[model samples]
Target: MAQWTVVRAQHPAELVAASHLFDGPVSHDGAADALARPGHVVLLARTPDGRDVGFVSGVEMRHPDKDPEMFLYELGVDEAWRRQGVASALLDALRDLARGLGCQGMWTGTEADNAAALATYRRAGAQVDRGSVFVVWDELDGEDVPAR
Candidate 1:
C-alpha cells in the first residue's frame, strides 16, 4: 500500500496547489474566500513524495436549536489512488476534525449510482439515510447546466 499524509489546508496556496483534485480549475480568490470563512475546511492528502492525491472539503453548519454539524461538501481522489484507502482516510480525518470542533455529527450526499463512493463511505462507518433525496437548484443565471 502507498503511504500518504493528510493535513488540513491552512492557506489558499495549499488548496490552489491541489487544483487537479477538483472537478474544474480552482480559483485562487475562491480558495481565499473559503479559507477566510469561519466554518469552512479543506483537507488535502499527499503522497510521500509530496504529490497531492486527494482532497475533502466541508462546512460546519449550526442551527439555533441544535449543535453544529459538518456538511461534507466534496471528496475527490486521483484515479490512480482509488480503492487504496485514500478516500477512507480523508473521511476519517474529516470526522476527527469535526469531533474536535464539537460538531454533533457529519453528513454528505452522493449519487446513488456511484458504487465506489457508496462503498468508501460504508467502509468509513457511515450509515446511509436511504430514503433521503438530494435536490439542487443550479445555474440561476439562466445558463443550462449539464447533467452529471
Candidate 2:
C-alpha cells in the first residue's frame, strides 16, 4: 500500500512539477490569485518518499441570492498514480476542508468527454449539475490568441 501526504503549498514554485496534471489555464498569475485569497485552498499530494503525485485546489464561493458553496478549482493525479485512489483522496480532503469552512456543498466542472475525471468525481459522491458556459475571448489580428 502506498501512503500519501497532503500539503498546502503557498508558493507557486513548489507546484511546478505537478502543473501538467491540471486542466485549465494555470500559470504564475493563477497560482498567485489562488494563494492570495483567504478563501482559497491550494494543496499538493505526495507519496511516502516525498515524490509529488497529485493536487487539488478550491475556492470558497458566495452568491448574493443563494447559499455559499465550495468551488473545486482543480484536481489532478498523474497517470502513474491514477488507479491508487489519489484523486479520490484529494477530493476527500477538499470536502473536509469545505465542511470545516461551513460550506453547504461543493461543485466542480470538467470537460464533458473526460470519462476518468467524471468517474472520479462521481465515485467521490459529487453531483453533476448540467449547465452552459459562455466564453468571450479578447480578439487578435487573425492569430489564435493575442500575446499576453
Candidate 3:
C-alpha cells in the first residue's frame, strides 16, 4: 500500500523530470514535442515528496468509421516500488483519462513471454486477445529503429 498521486503531465518539464521512468533517456526537445501533440498523453505517479515512481503514456487513435480508442504506449514503475500497486494505479489513471476523452476502448501489446506485464495488465481488467498478433517494422531506410 504505497501512497502516491497520479497526475496527467501538462508540461514537458514534468515529463523530463520523470525521465528515468521511461525506457530510454527523455530529452527536453522530445518531451516538448510529445506534449505538443494532440491525443498524446503522459501520466506520472509521484510520491508525496515529489518523486516520480511510475509513468504511463497513451495515444488516442481515430478512425473514419469508428469512435476513438486509446492505445496504451508504455508503462513503467521504479524497480524498488514495484508490487505496491503503482502500475495498477497508473493504468487506472490512464483508463479514466480515456473515458474522459470519450474513447470507446483502450488496448496495448506486450510480448507473450513477458509474464510480469501480462499479470499486471490482467490484474487491471485487460483481456487477452489470443487472435491478435503484433507486427512491427524494426528497420526503415536501411537503419534499425530502436525498440521502445
| Number of the predicted model whose lDDT against the real structure is largest | 3
Query: Could you tell me which residue pairs clash in candidate 2?
Result: none
Candidate 2 C-alpha lDDT tens digits along 1-148: 5488888887866666557767754688777776888888877888777677899889998888877789898787888888998888889888988898889999887888888888899999976666756365677566877468
Answer with 1 or 2, whichever has the higher lDDT: 1
What is the number of residue pairs that collide in model 1?
Answer: 0
lDDT score for residue 112 of model 2? 84
Error of 2 at 23 (Å): 5.0
**TM-score for each prediction?**
0.91, 0.78, 0.92
Tens-place lDDT digits, model 3, residues 1-148? 5599998898888888887888888888999999889999999999999999999999999999999899999999999999999999999999999999999999999999899999999999999888999889866765575567
lDDT of 1 at 75: 98
lDDT of candidates 1 onward, in order: 0.91, 0.81, 0.92
Say which prediction, candidate 1 or candidate 2, comes out ahead on TM-score. 1
At residue 14, give the lDDT of candidate 3. Answer: 88
Cand. 1 Cα-lDDT: 0.91
Per-model tally of clashing residue pairs: 0, 0, 0
lDDT by residue (tens digit), candidate 1, 37-89: 99999999998788899999999999999999999999999999888888989
What C-alpha lDDT, on a 0 to 100 scale, does residue 145 get in candidate 1?
A: 69
Clash-forming residue pairs, model 1 = none
